[model samples]
Target: MDTIPAILRAAAERYGDQPAYVEGARAVSFAELHDQVRELARRYVGHGLAAGEPVVVWGPNSIEWVIAALATTYAGGTLVPANSRYTGHEVADLVDRTGATVVMVADGFLGRSQVQELRAASDLPSVRAMGELSRLSLDHRGEERHVREVTIDEVEARADAVSPDDVADILFTSGTTGRPKGAMSAHRQSIGVARAWAELGGVSADDRYLVVNPFFHSFGYKIGILVGLLTGATLYPVATFDVDQTMQLIESERITLLPGAPTIYQSLLTAPGRAERDLSSLRLAVTGAAVVPVVLIERMRDELAIDHVVTAFGMTEAVVVTMCRDGDSAETVATTCGRAIPGMETRIDAPAGEAGELLVRGDYVMLGYLDDPAATAEAIDADGWLHTGDVGVLDDEGNLRITDRLKDMYISGGFNVYPAEVEQALMRMDGIQDVAVVGVPDERMGEVGKAYVVGTASADEVIAFARQRLANFKVPRLVETVEALPRNLSGKVLKNELRK
Candidate 1:
């Protein structure tokens, strides 16, 4: 499909009554999903969302989130998804950066009224409309004002106006600069990457896909949601990954396709009473976002009885870059993120068999970072190569093994945590003279943050202070008081020493 709206229309015609999305007690057929998206798009148009404008969707995974995200694109508006784990300050910064006109949040989710928090964080003068995602309808009065009902014809007109080159979503990813950058992807690129992933995984209409990744992430939104849309796979979105709840869903829903970080499969393998859960319906398991052990890959196939188990490597800039193919050996799947997919090219700056910065150029690469030309130029060179900021080695067979990162970022529970951002937040606290953060290996999480401080505050006090400011995954799990951090002659803190 050329665009997301086009995919929605085609899915309705192709899949007809086949189930598209199933959440708890509710399910929507492909046809029904198309109708719902159109209805919601009409409401968005009635609410004064203009073409090319950005709408921020900040919430957990649910059928409502699906509809709202799809409706935002269907209404000719760019989708800007915010991390649900973000505090009001984080969300406000994103909203301000995007100049979002409509901000839809999942109120009362996890016992917090997100809209109120966002309002309390900022005056939000640019936000002309705000509402709870669950209560988004033409007749429902939003926090700011009521929506003006518009006809389906108007919605169709807007959808027809959308081009493949139009920016579909602007996903924010933090950098070493301690600031988040919005990566803009066109409708074609989003659908293109999803289609590529779906083809590689052999996703089909009969497959029941269980999505455990957060919808705000590229893993969930692009590979999970869009892949399902392209392949007609019925999606089962899990708002949170509880072992018992996921196992119950797998048994009840007869889930066939499951993709998540390595930790998810590890949990399922070790959860109490896993054998009794009737997990025979699981056919495919795709995992990444953290190191995947060869033993874990074998266990997922042998213990869980999943027929197809694979691994991939991707980022927010380019959703699915390299992925292990079917029938790949366990070692290959575990140690390497297979060769580049179709429409993409991969190369290392170093000689063959040596590890260097990985570079990629592809049609599915993001358009650019939103409103940041200098940063965009630095990332994607004039030759169209996007410097991935990752150190990797390519073997004779062209398989890529990631070794290290040029950026001081780590993955905690599959979430990208930038140490610079954590250090920036901690420096704001009183009596904190200086700080340095690094990722330490963990048994449960792939990596957790550790902070080395040069200040008078106790470890517990610093941890408590961080809890109120940073997201849970970004918070340092361990703290150490040091007289000073080792620095280079150039006055730069040597992060390698801290990592050691």
Candidate 2:
């Protein structure tokens, strides 16, 4: 079961009649999912997609997106999930870079015709556009006798042909630092991470996972879909994170597992009608992608009634390398991300207790950025460590606490300011709900810190409060209140956007 098709076949047999995926009122059983994947595999093969070829599944979170991704593997093709928020130009560029032979996109998502928009923006060069399969009812009459009939055995046999070294996916990096590069990973790598994620999250067959994170992001796709497939859990796909609907789903659907960014939990805890809902069903929570406050974790456990609130640190290139364990202290879960998972090794470049770049090495790391040899060489050094540009520290107990991105560290006067440290300090202050700090140009001192507070605190008051807690040089020179900070689909603060 190192390959996706192998995993799919095992799940179908093991889970049988159990529901594997649920989208609103509709549910797809394991047996049905396997049948549909095989049927679609036939369709894909009929259209000439083969092993090692790329097929871009571009759409939001839905059952169709899931099938499209898995079916590509069943057809022995590589999956390239496009970010739903990508503009036409971005999508076209990605398609071109991947040399994708087929493009399966949602006909309409969130009320917009994405396929039409793509056609309008680019000619799409030489790719086949398959309209949304969200509601596709395949009534294949086996009319094409030339195309071989696909069965579970045949699918498994074909999956066997796809070697562990064959590229399973080419997930593109977030490109916050530079241009987005496709990070290629093999079947073994993908399968390894899937198992590790399930084990770390304590995912079980009886658990019902509410996936508020989009399918395009690694956390949602790897942990959300792959983990469910591996563990035989039921997956509830949530297209967007609406606090009211999510609260209702947790109550009515009896969702036990929910994983997303800190902002999602923050929204749920502070949501208008949250206290009135019966949220006692939530048991496990995983959050990352920003500075997580101790109070947030405490509220998620105490108020929301979630039992295990774990924090993890990962990126697309290297999936869940580190995660807080079940027996970790609340302070450990709150302050640090976690130690490295079983198969991987994590090291920081700086001295112990000092922040430096975090490096990871193991089966979890990607082969390299696709087609960008120089960049790939630079990322994964000769020593076999992937130089994660993220900055963090390894405490005495080996817990990893992320402080800032190497690119995000800014110099102020003669000192360096990690925005995450500044934000964490501001989060502890009263009347501040959320905060993001960025270095702004200051004639007096090369670059000074500017804080964006999402609360009722005034600019002058916040600056004064920070002055008392922080060193004179580290305190923010300016503070501004905003309705909300601009964030990417993954809920990471777009400090680059804030700078503009």
Candidate 3:
């Protein structure tokens, strides 16, 4: 009950014969997954790695991804999952920052990108490919079998001797700053988050989940994977986010639950044969990351036909605070981030209709930013409330409305301009897929607005469109058309990288 391993134990007892995980054509049962983790723990302990040391789970979403994670935790080590979409140097910078003791990457990860980083990494740790580990399926095939030279008896013997509360994972923050910050999470934190999500989402064993998002993100780990496990539900993992592929998988898998950015939902609306497909099985669709526009939410309501589209707002610091509740209004669902979840407190420094920096405090807030006391002090106040850098306003009912990001706001000619406002206006233009607005230095204006747009329209056309919607001062002075926007693994826009 205190850890995820306990839930694994429960599944082995009540649902051992049930299908626990299915990857493409391969399926592993409850007992099968538990046994696999047990052996994985032995393999890690067999190596010289000790508790609290870091082991990187670097790969596309796979059964092995979960296995490596569980095994690392079961062996009492910290797991660090690398973002598969990131460049090698990007990945190396993260690993180097965490100072991992060992890294588990898929074969040919280096060949995929210039992230030949881990190999050239100075003061590097041990590395392993998937097949190199002698751990087997821990299958109960009615007869004893050997996994390489090792037996199931050997694996179980090693697992039975371990303890919980050993550092389970060192989840490094998506490094917006040059150096990534590692958040040391325990087995208890995983369980706590999953439990909190179950209450927030009302998830159950009957729910069938479809997750296209990567597990490294807080939403995927806490809600997609962790909540699914807690509810005894079946989870369908899509390694990558392909709008067309997800549409088909939803029907094929009979998906009932989903949690991802509004981008996924936006893209799904355009999937071919979208209206032709039978998608009646879906019940819950949770979106986070960027704010959900009312138009997108309306299209989802009238088009995709999913009624209960819940939106929750949170960060790695505060687990999850605001979530639009059941029977909440479309305007509320689309605009106002709903009332605070149980055990969470929310406040706005400005008047009800005015914007202010959002503050959240709860049992789920992270202990502190790992090793950076100054940043920890700056982020979390003496009262223990985490000051989320997000800028938003509180409505009469205490629901929060996020207008723009504090960091993304800029000053132009002594006038304040929020890039989110400009980006939102540009996104409404025809053929526009995405748009990002930033501020660059201007001798006269201090900072001038610049827009990077991704769409079929030319720079002049976009500028023309923006000129009509915004004031002359607010209109972007520079427009660069790009194929796409740079985003982090969680689908959050990497504005820091975009600025560079």
Best by TM-score: 1
Model 2, TM vs. native:
0.80
Check candidate 2 and list the clashing pairs.
none
lDDT of each: 0.91, 0.80, 0.68
Give the TM-scores of the predictions, in the order they appear: 0.97, 0.80, 0.75
lDDT of 2 by residue, 201-238 (tens): 78899999999887877778888888888999999998
Q: Which ten residues in a row are the worst by lDDT in model 1?
A: 137-146
Candidate maximizing lDDT: 1
Task: Rank the candidate models, highest TM-score first.
Answer: 1, 2, 3
- Writing each residue's lDDT as its tens digit, candidate 1 over 206-297 gives 99999899999998999888988899999998888899999999999899998998989989999999978899999999888887889999
Flag regions of model 3 displaced more than 4 Å: 109-117, 123-166, 174-177, 351-353, 409-500
The C-alpha local distance difference test score for the whole of candidate 3 amounts to 0.68
Q: Lowest-lDDT window of 10 residues in candidate 3?
A: 133-142
How accurate locally is residue 24 in candidate 3, as Cα lDDT from 0 to 100?
77
lDDT of 2 at 396: 81
